[model samples]
Target chain A: MPGVCASSTQSPLEGKVSKVKWPTYLSLSLVAMILGVLLVFQFRVVRYIEQGVSLGRVQELTVELRQLEKEKLKLAAEASDLSAKLQQAGQGQAEAEKALEGELEKARLLAGLVPVTGPGVEVTLDNPPANRGWATSLYVIRDEDLLRVVNELRGAGAEAISINGQRIVATSEIRWAAPFINVNLTRLVPPYHILAIGNPGNLRSALEIPGGLVEYLQELGVQVKIQAHDRLTVPGYNRPLEFRYAKPVVKE
Target chain B: MWLGVWLTLLGLILGVIVGLNIPMVLTKAHAKYLSVAVLAALDSVFGGVRAAMEEHFDHTIFLSGFFANALLAAGLAYIGERLGIDLYLAAVVAFGVRLFQNLAIIRRHLVRGIKRG
Candidate 1:
């Protein structure tokens, strides 16, 4: 297996060297070259395929949304028809009463005039102290905290909400930057204002709900105000909905 | 070409894992040898598949196909790895190259057939 060339032409030491070294060097170099080329080509292909897969996923989601909208319309029409029949028979008193109750609740929430309920405390978080430590500087408002607050607010039946004067929408984002946080891209600093246009009385208590974020923040010495604003108005969804990828795809 | 590419990818992955796990066995020199052998094997597989598909009927066809495929795969794979690229991407390029080559050959054959008719 040593360097035995065709026609049996090999020098003595050269034969041993070729047998032991040349084969290894040649094989290794060849493999290295091949691997390099393949890697380049494969990466390009993978990128192309990944883009295609992402597009396909978006198309699939669009189809699902269209199906859901059809179902919603069908259900709404059925409910309206049933209500009309009940009214014609003069047997819609209970339904009418319920509707009135709903309207009254809405008006109260709109005026921010609801009483607080349950046992909860409020702790408004302030900017880091002037003599803040390194850790405190890094303790800026994070996306997780904003998400937590929103989840808790919804759970507490918060009728409406606003952060730093900007109304919270379905697709609002609370992005964090250096020392500042954004509520739908509007920047604000401590003491961060978060207005809940709900039953102020209920909201005061909701803010202090046990096993809640407010309690945790209070322990951390964050300042929180839970005052009942008799005439606080939670601004409506004023921001336009911008769907980068959620638009319906019309199939030809 | 496609088969060759896939084989190369499989070989590359195998080589990487084996090289990492058995570091004791992977002398720089040994690694080099393994790289070449793996690439060659992958290429040979592709050539064999192509020959089978085309129904080429020479004695020693399998040996010849294997040698040719191995050499081609090794050549392409080396180019890919040197560029810090992925084996799969390399395989894709190899496939494209092979496809184009075959298409050209087929076109010539078709033209020749038309002339005879």
Candidate 2:
């Protein structure tokens, strides 16, 4: 071993004195253990960040979201079935039943349960030209603009409305979800095309009113275009609308 | 000398398996510190290997160097982050240069051993 060390080393004293001691073995092993643990931790941390998910929280949330969606669909189906049964039970009173059915249809339209088509206006809101070199804040259409436009349309007697194909139900929310606008929990990008089912003349006049939402948005440098169409179709709400707490009073 | 390598490899394998199975001890916030410390530890390991090859390996020096270097590197990184300076880059470059230098020395010793054998 000494001869081999001598051959391996440049200096002879180094060859003899640097013999591997027992304590050296112990310390090296300990260092090796630490290095090993650190390497593993580093690897795990990198993987976690890259995957963008906590150890189990993301998976748990995803499972929960899916389960809730399923429950909502089931409850919606059950509600529709009960309504149909109520309509059938009232078949004995013909005139009252017909009037009741008509009222139910109007309610369904208002509730965004059925798609509707009529003469209405389509309002398109877009960011101003990119060459303007203005800050995003200057040209971007904000959530408040969308909410005001929707309110104006409803005030103009719009029976139904849809924004970017997402039916704007009574409970639909329009707000900023960072980078995009969330309507009915669906992310929408520019340019937003808002289609309102109403009298085209009335909707256009409502928007063109002095100091109204359209003017306010235009002043903010947002491009606003309102085009009235002879016919426009608004889709039914796609998401399950479950009324968990609202129960109908039993008219005994 | 080979015994040290074997023990390190075993420890590494055991660590990986345990790390995979066990819950994470470190949080995302400490990732930068861990990275700098790992680099420092690597530099020390290579330095140890170089010392072994040169026949001047000291147990106390290697042990002290390992812990001190790791802590110092991590500390520098933490302080740099607080001070809004990238001090980990300095640690990385320094340790990286030493690691390569030690590797080169170890390689030379291995080549000499092979020729003699």
Least lDDT summed over 10 consecutive residues: which range in candidate 2 chain A?
A1-10
- Residue runs of model 2 more than 4 Å from their true location after superposition: A1-16, A53-252, B1-5
Cα displacement (angstroms), candidate 2, residue B69, comes to 0.4
DockQ of each: 0.02, 0.17
Backbone clash pairs in model 1 (N, Cα, C under 3 Å; residues 3+ apart or in different chains), count: 46
Expressed as tens digits, the lDDT of each residue in A32-125 for candidate 1 is: 3444444443444444455554556777989999999999999999999988997876656777788899999987545434442323223355
Best by lDDT: 2
Q: What is the interface RMSD of candidate 1, in Å?
A: 14.3
Q: Write the per-residue lDDT of candidate 2 for residues A1-252, one digit (tens) a residue.
A: 213211112222434456566667767777787887888888888887877767488779999999999999999999999999888876757878788999999888778989999899999999876776654455677788888999999999998888999999888999998789999999999999999989999999999999887888888878899999999899999888999999999998
Identify the leading candidate in terms of TM-score.
Answer: 2
- lDDT tens readout by residue for model 1, B1-117: 354445445655655554444323333322332444444444443433333334441213333343454454555556656776655356455545654565565566667769989
